[model samples]
Target: MTAYNKEEIIHQLESHQLWIDTLGKEGNKLGFDEVDFCNIDIDLIKYPLDQAYLTACTFDGMNLYGKDMHSSLICSSTFITTNLENADFYKADVSYVDFTNANVKNARYAKSDCSEAIFIKADLTNAKLISCSLYLTDFREATLKNVDVSSSSFKGVLLKGAKLSGIKGLEDAFIKSINIGTPEIPILIEGEEAVQWIINNCSTDEQI
Candidate 1:
């Protein structure tokens, strides 16, 4: 992770604006070096980003902790192994984003679109995703501890072998074709199979 000055980093980001719309059309954006675009406080820029179109920008091993990216359109961006802890992603469209092995702990993604996003082996502990649209998102072997997924749509999402311990708010989340691991806590979904499985698991315990 090579470090650059504030002026040098801003120049690189500004130069890639023309090609940020489509990938391979102009040129490649975002280097492997650590560019602190979020932590910069310069006189040139007034406020942070809004509705920023950052397509195909790779952010591998970057620390994007606690950034508010509300309503941003980040399509086809690769966030490989990035630390996205406690990021406020309200209604953001992160379709086809590679979040594989990223630290997404306590991330709030209310009404966000995470369709086809890969979350393989990511530490998503205590993440709250209220009313979010997660159609066909991959959650293979990810830790979903205490995740609040209320009123969300999980159509065709792969949750096979995911650690869903202490997960909350599944009363309205659609579970079509989603692979459920051995639920330690009581699941809050519809269907006779789900009810029976919870009943069987709760029979030995005193609480229902």
Candidate 2:
């Protein structure tokens, strides 16, 4: 419940960077709770934010390529149009985050709780979402080619216009009612029928 000013936040970040640079021998790791990071420039911050509590932060349009954010609490954050390619979000609490138009290709979201998150038009090609909680998440018009969603929960997820060619582990996922059409039109499907439609429509070799 501590609030930090910009200068104090910068000092902590510098110390964390030193810790990362010296392999945890020089400084302490960054670990803040209930802090707001909307005003901060995320580009200047160092990578490997593992186990940090970054709840409700806004990282719009930032280049966060290959950042190690595993086990972080990033719930309700906004990453609009951010370049999150190769970012490791393993076991992170990403619930209700907005990733609209973000380039999240090859990101690792295994064991993460991504419930109610928005991925509208985001490119998640080749991403690993195994054992994740995706309940009520939106993926409208997103590119999910070759993505592995093994043992994930997709209850009430939106998949309208999402490219799912070469996607893996549909049978292993626990899917409930999902939207396969626009929000205005609202075509809902469930169980085996929904899986079949996703496979038949998106499993084609034709380019999307």
Candidate 3:
């Protein structure tokens, strides 16, 4: 990934002000439908980047603490090893994004579409994903302590090798479409039973 300095980020914002809104914009302002942030590590923690369209960007090892990205479109971005602690992605479209080994503790992804996103070995402790779309998302070997996925869509989701201790809202989550790799676990389960399965089996067994 390319290392982006502050000057480049400023230039991109200025050149693409019509398309890119560095901070949240007011009424009658136009921002880029999608910002090209490929292979750049830009620190966006200080700015509120809501309603941005940033596809195919690489944010590897960037620190994005407590940033607000509500209603943004960020498909196919790479956030590998990035620190996204307490970041708010409410109702964002983050399809096909890669968040492997990223620190997403206390992050909020409520009502977001995260289809086909990769979270392998990512630290997602206490994250909130209520009513989010997670179709075909991969969370293998990820830490999910106290994460909330209640009422979320989990069709074809990968939970193998995932550490799911104290995770909440699994009972209410739709898990009929999960890919656990083995048929030993029941194909269909209610909310309470699913939580029990995570606690009893996922904690003790090697799901890979």
Candidate 4:
């Protein structure tokens, strides 16, 4: 039982506000057990983590509020300027994670996979992400206010100047901006003939 020391996780993150006043109410909070701790990169701006696993870690300027991080894997992690508000990370795997300038507001990430992640300028305001897949991810200028993004599978992704205000399933969501703009003007609220049959047969090609 001698594994926790990055100065004991920055002295339990200065003794409060450390993952919601200690492990978000101590319902299985990990102060240190990142797969039995053999140094899995725990600096995070000199440490203050919660329910940590932090696989392949790098985390800069860390705070990590309300952390649970169930089923942690966190492959190829980075997460610069991290705070991770309301963190849960359920079904976590998080492949190729970068999450630059991270906040992850209201984070849950239920059924998380996050393949090829990058999330530059991340906030993810009101994030839930139920049944997540996020394939080929790299949410440039990410905000995603009131996010729900249901039954997701966004292949070859890159939402340039991303907004999509208050998303809900988004049908068969697969946007590289449908090939460099000028074709995304469908909001009729009654399926406008199934969104013009996906603008006359989908797959406009964002890039190979």
Among all candidates shown, the one with the greatest lDDT: 2
Per-model TM against the reference: 0.67, 0.84, 0.76, 0.29
Q: How close is candidate 1 to the true structure, as a TM-score?
A: 0.67
Listing every candidate in turn, what is its Cα RMSD in Å to the true structure after a full C-alpha superposition?
Answer: 8.4, 3.5, 4.9, 12.4
Query: What would the TM-score be for candidate 4 when compared with the true structure?
Result: 0.29
Ranking by TM-score: 2, 3, 1, 4
Overlapping backbone residue pairs in candidate 2 total 0
* Best TM-score among the predictions, by candidate number: 2
List residue ranges in candidate 2 displaced over 4 A: 1-6, 15-45, 182-186, 203-208
- Candidates' C-alpha lDDT: 0.65, 0.84, 0.74, 0.59
The collision pairs in model 1 are none
In candidate 1 the C-alpha lDDT for residue 31 amounts to 37
Put down candidate 4 lDDT per residue, 1-208, tens digits, no spaces: 3356566655555553444565565433433323323244553434334335566555555676766666677766676767878888888888788877689888988778887787766878778877777766776556766677666655555545454455555664433222112124322212344334334432322211
**Residue-level lDDT for 70 in candidate 4:** 60
Per-residue accuracy of model 1 over 104-141 as CA lDDT, tens digit each: 99998888898888888788888888888877777877
The superposed Cα distance between candidate 3 and the true structure at residue 126, in angstroms, equals 0.2
